[model samples]
Target: MKIQAKSLVDTVAERLEEAIIGGELAPGERVFEQVLAADYGISRGPLREAIRRLEGRRLLERTANKGVRVVDLSPERLEELLQVRESLEGMAARLAAGQIGDDEVGELRKLLETHQETSLEKGYYQQSGDFDFHFRIVQASGNGFLISLLTEDLYDLLRLYRYKSSTMVGRAEQALAEHHAIVDALAAHDPDAAEAAMRTHISNARTHARMALERAEAEAASTAEG
Candidate 1:
């Protein structure tokens, strides 16, 4: 394994993040440095750095003697995470209403259009990472403290649950409609409306997530019975 990319560490971190989110690296799966380095075609040096970064993000956990594995979040923890997200992201939308530029508002509109296409044609929800509505709104908020808390501290965990939870029956279209409501409030520069819409959207997401989890549990139970 050799490093050719300029920022090999960052590249590897991002790829690993994607793999975890995409379920290529399943939750709680043990990670082996030697195998992963060979698989990713990067040296253990940079790959180790990437793993450490993810550890900081709480995406991976290291155990004494047991070694490192992807963080496997329990249902209770995921609910707690969503509670924090609802508070912080609601504040972000409120702040963004005051601070967002006209250009950024247009960017939000265009991003919605892209999401609309994907939702309609491809039959999925929003994009992850930079193209995400939540990501853009947090950027628009222009508050470094909130930005760091949401993006650096909790972004990956949030995204993982968001992607997983969104598969609830008929949730994709509803979530897109919620996004439109949120963007409308932001575009109007109404702090109250923006915060309300964002909070509502997050609350709805939490509900859908619970429903999805319950459905999965029921299906698993039925399979076991059979």
Candidate 2:
């Protein structure tokens, strides 16, 4: 009975995490336990447990009287998160340049080729393709701690923010060019160049996100005054 209960809780948590990361559950949106419990046909016990797990994952937050809400992706928080990513992903790229096998390099090149083709055809970079490229590099870094930090701890939140940021005008093509530079450094097995490229890419992403947020806020203020 206990084992079954745990399984149900895990299921609920995974579903909720997907919903949040997929943008079905918008950031700062409150989660209603009763409605969710009823929708999933689960009791509040397991549902509450699932919410608690998401809290641990940093996907949800609970206040004294406000209940659980999805973590808000404000501009300030976005900058902080991107700064951390710049440092971590830069290190990952540097290590990967030294540690990646020839086959992995080939795979990365193929993926970039696909990205270029798709972007040219679709007029934007595919978000999944971008994620795949970053994920592959981090995995090839051969640093277990870095892998876990990126894949396990940060990926869900990263997906959420990436989805939001990808909407910025002209960002897709710019990001593709930056990705090409990173791939070039990796192909040459130059750790310093790889790290520099990764840092610059993430820094540019941060700036784009900030500018988008500022534009959104300005639009909102203009609407209010109008």
Candidate 3:
């Protein structure tokens, strides 16, 4: 079987994206192309191609002389992203409420139930599970453009922040409860309720992100001063 160059590049890009979103590659960390190429046992060509793909996804940025680095998530940027999410996902939920099937609702219910059990057992919600719940709702909305915007364009960046937000004290439990409310609205086929619930959930997440960022900055400042 012949492996296509594009496929290989995309595979490499996916691995790098997972590393970035999983926090293995810290935000603002430089990408040492040669080192990564050597580590992956691939040539620099595919590595560069992978970097270009990640850059297109906004997961990486190239500075004038500093080369490529992971995109940093700032509080202001996080707020902007979540504001867009609230608007987009709120609409998605509203549409989903009207269009989602009974089976889809059942799937969502099972997901929520699993999340509840896992959160209780692990003492926190898994970021991947949280994303799965929202992703399922967006998929149920039956809007191709909306799906592309949320899943294709913004999903990786969303995961990065969601991973960070999941670490903020009490956020996982609160988000679990919010997920239940959103699912309740969806199950009842209440578009207005679904939209409001989604908006509130994203809004709360944005607030938590802002507070977490502020605390991080303060700690950094104190450390620098000391």
What TM-score, over all chains together, does every model reach?
A: 0.86, 0.80, 0.86
Model 2: per-residue lDDT, tens digit, 111-215? 878877775444343353244778888898999999999877987666666656666888888888888899889989999999999999888888877786777
Local accuracy by lDDT, each model: 0.85, 0.82, 0.84
Better of 2 and 3 by lDDT: 3
Question: What lDDT tens digits, residue by residue, belong to model 3 across residues 98-182?
Answer: 9888888888889878877776444343454334888888888999999999988998788777767776888888988998899
lDDT of 1 at 208: 81
| lDDT for model 3 | 0.84
- Give the per-residue Cα lDDT of candidate 1 at 199: 95
In model 1, the runs with Cα more than 4 Å from the true position are 1-6, 119-129, 213-226
Query: Which pairs clash in model 1?
Result: none
Residues 1-226 of candidate 1 have per-residue lDDT tens digits of 3446978999899888888877689778899999989987877999999999999999999999989999885678879999999999999999999978888989888988887777654434455667988998998889999999998899888887887678776778888898889888988999999999999999988888777667756876899999
Q: Of the candidates shown, which would achieve the greatest lDDT relative to the real structure? A: 1
- Give the worst 10-residue stretch by lDDT in candidate 1: 119-128
Sliding window of 10 residues with minimal summed lDDT for model 2:
122-131
Query: How does residue 140 of candidate 2 score in lDDT?
Result: 83
